[model samples]
Target: MYKIAVIGLGYVGLPLAHAFASKYEVVGFDIAEWRIEELRKGIDRTLELSEAQVNEAIANKMLFTNKLEEISTRQQLNPKKRISDNVYHSYQIFFEYKESYYPNSNKPNNQ
Candidate 1:
């Protein structure tokens, strides 16, 4: 079983994580504790996914967390294997320029 870690559970990352959860073990990591709690409660405030979709991902055994340590443990599961051995996707790069897009907001650019 392949384990996938998605290091941003925003619009792009959340949907991507849910899609991957259907076929692989998925760990959806976000910096926001609120976001983690929302997902765990089957809520997707971003609206990229419906509550049912979030629940389905949970039912599929997807893990959502706000802790980097949790993701680190998953990556370290196969220490001998390189990072490429597992599926790792990160949408955080887009967040770097979020300020420019939002022009004062810290939220990600959904458009």
Candidate 2:
């Protein structure tokens, strides 16, 4: 089973993460603590997903977090595979490719 990390959890990432959660172990990562809290409570402030949809994702065992450590642990659990390769993101997020956990990761180019 692939573990996917969707980095952003805004309009794009949240929906994608929820869709993926149906088939994969998904971690929805965002930098805002409040956003994380809201999602955990089954709230979608961005309105991209309904509260029902948000709660469904939660019920599916999707992990929503702002901590890099949580996603990092998923990488370790699937060490043989590149968890970063499964990462989905919106244009707002950028990755420093040099980051150890994302060695094989590609930083999205908005250009």
Candidate 3:
């Protein structure tokens, strides 16, 4: 079974870690202490995941931590990064590209 480590736990990492945990061992790393605390308590302030969903993921061994040292250790043990392609762009552009196949997603919607 593949071991996975996800960095950053915003909308992207949380879900990705959860999905990976269904098949592989997964650890989610985030710099934000509050975010990790919330996740540990089965709360997702981003509203992407319900409490039950988070709890289920946790039950399956999907874990969240705010320790950079732990993340570095995991990285040395298993080198990998799981960031969303959309994270590189603004939400508007990301959503546009996600919805349509047009090459020029940057064009004004009115055009």
Candidate 2 regions exceeding 4 Å error are: 74-111
Which candidate ranks first by TM-score, i.e. highest? 1
TM-scores for every predicted model: 0.66, 0.66, 0.62
lDDT of 2 by residue, 21-56 (tens): 998889998876778988999988789999999999
Q: Taking the candidates one at a time, how many backbone clashes does each contain?
A: 0, 0, 0
- Candidate numbers, best lDDT first, in rank order: 2, 1, 3
- For candidate 1, the TM-score is 0.66
lDDT measured at residue 44 in model 3 versus the true structure, 0 to 100: 89
Residues 68-91 of candidate 3 have per-residue lDDT tens digits of 445444334423453332343354
Rank the models by TM-score, top first. Answer: 1, 2, 3
RMSD from true fold, candidate 1: 6.1
Superposed on all Cα atoms, the candidates' RMSDs to the truth, in angstroms, are 6.1, 8.9, 10.4
Pick the winner on lDDT between candidates 2 and 3: 2
Give the Å error, residue 105, model 2: 27
Per-residue lDDT for 21 in model 3? 79
